[model samples]
Target: MTSSAPAPVAWAILGFCAVALVLRLLWLSGQVRSSERLVTYGLLLGTASGLLRERAVQDGLADLGMLSVGLTRQLSTVVMVLTFAPLCLLAISWSERWPARQAGISGLVWASAYASGIAMLVVGTHARSLELYIDRAEGWQTPVYFAFFSGWCGATGVLMTYTSIKELRAGDLRPIHRLTYLTILVVGAWALEEALSIFVSSVCAATGTGGGFVEFRFRANENNYIYLLAGGAMVAASGVVSELARRLRIDPASRAVRQLTPMWEDLIAACPEIPRPANPDIRMSSRRRVHRMTVEIRDALLVLGRYAEPVPDDMGGHGGEAVQIVRALRRKQSGAMPGQYLRLQASAPGRDVLDEARALSKITKHWNDARKCPEAIPSLDGDRAG
Candidate 1:
């Protein structure tokens, strides 16, 4: 990098990197605690570092008077690989089942990639005069130094592409998974370009065979086309990831909670103590709030069950999930101990709670409607008798 500005293409890529960073940060906010989470984190940090390097070149920071000449440029360039090395580790570890063997393989490969990145940056720093330009036939360190960084990128690309393909073939594949595969594929193409550039440039430098390659208008002797395409792919992947994150979002509000809301409110209104918070943390999402409310209501219903007049004919046996829960509530109210009620509860499983809630809602809806109109039903004096 020199005092002169980098090409317009680099500037455009940097702009895309900024967007990618923003999207990755949003993705990280989600609740997925898996290896893919680590991958997204690494991508965020790496893209930010890329932006740092691009800014160093775009602004010609080497020419600044207050700062040491070439200091910012070198640091930014080094940071590029430093930040990306972790992504290599995370990418390789993205498989569903990480057995001991797979874990060991990923660890060794990550170590190699990270060490090579560091060694590359160090070798570049110790170069003569710190001049950024190095033609294919010019210097030994340039090709060798680039080879280290390229190797890591190539390895990472191969791992991610393989992982994405497996994910694509997974049963009941989702929209997010598909977009994630697309992102990995685009990045894989970019990595191939980088590897090809290293091979071609190193060959030219080694054999002293210099023919005209597809050089850039601004950075002559450099494969600007490769970088341009790579940067564009990254930007596209960023958009795909953003869409994936949006699609994969888990709505905190559960359907059970929504249908049970009116019933829950009415029940708690009669027995205020039933609505006690399960946890002190008030910062949970709306869905969590609904779940907590559902729990409280279940407890309250058990108490109400104690006061249930008798097992109505329609509610006996496996009439309906809702009535069955109501019957259980009545059983609990009738003098069944905690262990008895818990045994019944465990039989239902968590998945059926929503159906139970819906049935309970119907009962509450009738009660509320009657309560709203005095003439609709008989006296509601013993509704909360328990």
Candidate 2:
């Protein structure tokens, strides 16, 4: 049978799946646990399976002698089945705190189920061609094969739906996390669609009737399967995008650390009482380093408080604070005697360490510029002599 031209919606769904596949791969490239990797791989495979359903992709594979329509269908089905194993593991992992041994056993069981499904597909179905399968060749094996496949898919769908719903019902989920679970629900729906399609097709084939409500419903579900898969993939991709965006926002902490380093060093050097971190290693993430440095700078400011001179109200911004800090550093370094302890404000009020770092970063910029133009910094001697 000649393959029909792909509909516009089919192309759109395929395109969406392809993009989601790329995004999931990129997300997997970052730091992830083994279970996270498994789930991500499953998502990638599911998206890929959706893409494989496109007539264009099948034709391309056929052109390369890699896949005929029949083989493409089989491969897509197998990959989708494979996708559920990892997903099943993910659902189990998410639903409860299982011991490693229990988790491993669960994974193995899912793997065995996936293998069983593939074995049935290979051994039970005589027809490898799509036309033969769809045309309802007279055979008990075909019905049995579909029955097993449908049952496996249905079980997987039920598990996924259960897990997703349970997680979504929790009160503490962030909006993005809630969205991710909702997408998993969509995936579960897709799985159920597949199960229904397979079961109905098998029943119709067995009954030798292809032109009624049963056939119409089967065709409708079959057509919707790829769209459902694509929708799930797109939502999952959005979750990945959200994660990446959050990381991108945090990544600037590294730059902030670098910017504040000179100011931090100057303060620490002048106030030798400031204790350094024990493990000042490169392995620390940017956010942690920024927090540590912010705390250290604040402590150093307090230690050098006695040498600090109050800046005029007119000079009260970050640049003014930068000037005050610079003068205090000079006074402390010059061995000036402690006077009335006046606390110097070096940064604006901030909500968190990252915000504090950003505030301090502005001071560091002004401090660096003042050092380059020494005349811009008010002298400690001028303050001491006053």
Candidate 3:
């Protein structure tokens, strides 16, 4: 703002806006479609406009000529002017609890915002003429432009805070509480900062040394410090948003699920009766297939559990459940049905799919080898039905 120069905070705000844009794009990459996403798009555009304005002033575009300064002023007004649409979309989405009435209310807000934005754009051409500048808007221009800017940002901030709190209260798992609250607080803090800036500019206009209609300005260092802090807040929020999107994306290549493949293949080969999922999607997330395989494996083990011969009293718990299977198999009559008698005693594969699958593979190897031993066990028909 000093000598028509941009503050470092202006650059920081631009960075924050870029961070927000990246986060929104990442979130969208997961195929998330909603009004909130639309809001993100609007915010992205608004922030982009803010960035251009900052750069315009920073590069001393105005020093080139009066036409350049006018363009710079127009750019400043346009920055907030661009935010209304996305903020309104957010407001509409936030009011989902009362859809019938919410749409009407949101429409009104939207109309008012666009109307204000158009008016500001028309009059804002004279923004450079005002005595005092706030966020690059002059004294007379500041109030009109921020009236719209503050409304959009302020309303969205409140709604988002409420949404985050509601989600926190409803969620049962405690691990996510940190992310949820952090998102809410960071967003609220940044919104409050911008909203407060609007008010500060108004105060400066009324009470500063300008005597009601003279240009007022602040030191670049002081302004940059505040922008940097606000930008940091936004960057932190962007990180959280990025992580949340990543967590929510469908995992088409799950390492744990892939590990289960070797074990599952062996199980099905040994016991063809283990039902496979019908018409599985080749591109579906591996987690889904993992679920089906784990369930069938559990069922197959239960069937085998019935055929298990009594553990010899001499054996000491057979080195836990898995080793017991090997010992019992090695000692069973040639006719014993290992498929029916085998017990799945390890952790269910769904929770620790990779770990359990590897363990199962080891067990599978042992069972296959034991079946080949000289016991010459008879087939199911050769031995009496258990």
User: What is candidate 1's local distance difference test score?
Assistant: 0.52
Candidate 1, residues 1-386, lDDT tens digits: the string is 33223557666665666566566556544645444455555555555544444545435544555444344444444455554565566665565565445657666755765677567656665443545433333457766766765666677677767777777777455576688687777777667666667556655654556545523311531234326435544743654564564455433244445556775765565455564755557666555666676677777766554434333344333223334344444334344433322222222334554544544545554544433432322223434312
- Lowest lDDT 10-residue stretch of candidate 1: 338-347
> Total clashing residue pairs per candidate?
6, 0, 8
- lDDT string, candidate 2, 54-78, tens digits: 6777788999998677767656666
Candidate 3 on 240-339: residue-level lDDT in tens? Answer: 4655643665343254455446545544554556677667688664556666666766665555454554333443321234444433433333335444
Cα lDDT of all candidates, in order? 0.52, 0.69, 0.52
For residue 308, model 2's alpha carbon misses the true position, in angstroms, by 18
Pairs that clash in candidate 3: 9-227, 131-214, 131-215, 304-340, 334-377, 334-378, 335-377, 335-378
Taking all chains together, each candidate's TM-score versus the true structure is 0.54, 0.60, 0.57
Model 2 regions more than 4 Å off: 1-27, 57-68, 95-99, 106-110, 134-139, 186-190, 193-201, 209-211, 235-276, 287-386
Q: What lDDT does candidate 2 reach at residue 287? A: 68
Residue pair clashes in candidate 1: 136-205, 252-287, 253-287, 305-329, 305-333, 306-333
Superior by TM-score: candidate 1 or candidate 3: 3
